[model samples]
Target: MVTIRLARFGTKKRPYYHVVVTDSENPRDGRFLEQVGTYDPAKPIESARIDLSRVDHWVGVGAQTSTRVRHVLNDYRRATQAIA
Candidate 1:
């Protein structure tokens, strides 16, 4: 199953993540098909960057989002909405 999830990166203590499309069997931070976004917990939640168009395309093609990704997407959506 293809899934949309976060791949951990950055140095120890300082964490960063790439929102990627990959097979469910793949290990976290392992090989991935594509990176659709980025998350830096050190920054504000609104600062997370995601390509919503790509995300929608992936979702349309049956990609399931991880819980944390879903939460980030929701917060991003709210932030964008508020700015508009």
Candidate 2:
């Protein structure tokens, strides 16, 4: 099973996350199939940058998204549709 979740990165004091797709059995920071976005927790506004098309592709291929990722996707979809 493939899971879409966050992969931790960056220095000890400052952290960032890569929203990634990986096997459910893999470690949190282990082997991952694709990097779809980034999350910066420390940003004043709590920002995330994502590739909506890639996320949609993964969803189409049966990747089960984490709860947080689901929220992000919802926002992304709303924003894209509003623009379109």
Listed in order, each prediction's TM-score against the native is: 0.95, 0.78
Candidate 1 Cα lDDT to native: 0.94
Compute the lDDT of residue 26 as modeled in candidate 2: 98
Winning candidate number (TM-score) = 1
With a 3 Å backbone cut-off (N, CA, C), the pairs that clash in candidate 1 are none
Clashes of each: 0, 0
Residue 63 deviation, candidate 1, in Å? 0.6
Off by over 4 Å in 1: none
- Provide the global lDDT of candidate 2 against the true structure: 0.84
